[model samples]
Target: MHWSTLVDAVVVAHQPHSADPARYDIVLGAGVRSEESLFDLPAAPRFELFAGTTVAAASAGRCSAVDGLFKPRADPAPVPMELIGCEPAEPLLAALRRPRRSERNWVHLLVLDRHGAEMASRTVGLAITGARPSVLGGTLIDITLTDGGDERPSLAARPIWAQWYQGPPAEPNLWAPYDTQGRAAWLDLTTRAWRVPAPRPDRSGGEHHLDGRFVTDVPGLHCAIAEALLGPGRYFGREWNAFKDCLCGGFGVAPPFTLTWHDAEIARRALADVVEDQEDGLSYFEDIVRLLERYGVTVVLR
Candidate 1:
């Protein structure tokens, strides 16, 4: 598909590479870079961030009218962009020359498609928007400071969970935030094709010099959850255990945090392992759901 075909929407003026601007500070600018191939599509997408999201701008004037507890202000910062699926990438070259027609503004971005349908969207994150490694279209944005994206230079060095069993992950240790099938997947507009090394083994069986190929549980789910927790560096031994931590406490999501746990017929029987069979009460997992509500975590049991 053409690179533009892949995008659903563009939310500009975001903290470079940060999926959650509310949780992370915004870099004043995140350099965007893009390039094209004669036979293939542009390596990545590109757009410049402005002052704020349209959502924030719409609310600005209304806030001043609050009667009792209110204050008037100028240049109120834009509400942080949602990072549900986007982050910052490497900056375009330092000496970029933006087209005179391409101007920056103080607003959120959500341009519709030519068809007037919802556009394909990319999460606002760090991206390299340049034609070449050294050339830039404009003063590019930097994402090395964001915790889960290119804003933070340290992300490049983090150990991917796919190879946690090894001393360190294989060469080019980058964060693989998505689990497409069993292998780890992350967004990289630079590469000709988005492919990565195989996932680390989940177990070692009877004796063997080399590692086993089979993963103990669902590797993709684990990788996805790991990304949710900020890249793959925080892989634990088991996917289930890791999920438990997120479900109960050790992890967090955007506001109105909701967790849904599904149980099999066998899972219901396992309730014996938790609380004794309650004549009129909930199951073990259901009890956990109730407890989580006390912490303001909305858990839906299935």
Candidate 2:
């Protein structure tokens, strides 16, 4: 029935060329949903790469294909991703380099069945990439699951997103205007999220971030993001408002935002007056942090 494959265990290690790739060095083990051996089975099944946490990968990078997605890192001819294995069953691990952040990476190493069919196509979670217990003092580590189990996983889930649109928005990613006729069009999006950046450039009137909390991104950074994405009306426009509205919530969808460590660090070190003001009725920023967490969105550094 099956050509039977070889190689029982799956492993990912830093490529020989990686010396300083301590942070980028990654490891992976494979598991199937059907609880079958991956070693010497079918000839060649397909594979892909995606996310555990939403922010770094595409789902975490770009949920809304039409509206707004993160800036693409195109210069590096081969960006790290969906790295398919060579054979259906004998492919070995290759070196994958990524950012040095401490975020956990939930990778889907989907292995397909031999006939290019789905009945036996398996989606496996190479769940060993992130925040697991320390092993080998390696900056990046991967391990096999002690208790064998079947694995089925789809890609990219960002900060927990609550899609509340009554109808689909004219665009993707941003909140939909109304709930679709039925809840089928949208994937209930993975606000599968988590949290950004800095500074105290004073305007004498106000600040982009105030007292250990972000009122918003710095004007310059905002300008950069806006200019790059919004263009024409960099200062104000429907697109800009939609971005803020998506985070601010209440109109329809809830605020689909989360703060990262780099973000909170800036808040904590903000001017004391800004961090906690006596005259301004306790920074609402603290409240926002708590709210994000309440939604199961972790407010921590990635």
Q: Compute each candidate's TM-score over C-alphas.
A: 0.20, 0.18
TM-score, candidate number 2: 0.18
Q: What is the C-alpha RMSD of each candidate to the true structure, in Å?
A: 20.5, 23.9
TM-score of 1: 0.20
Write the residue-wise lDDT of candidate 2 on 75-156 in tens digits. 4232122222223121122312322221233333432224222111233333223223234444433334221224322222
lDDT of each: 0.31, 0.28
Distance from true position, residue 144, model 2, in Å? 75
Give the candidate number with the greatest lDDT: 1
Lowest summed lDDT across 10 adjacent residues in model 2 is found at: 188-197
| Location of the lowest summed lDDT over 10 successive residues in candidate 1 | 57-66
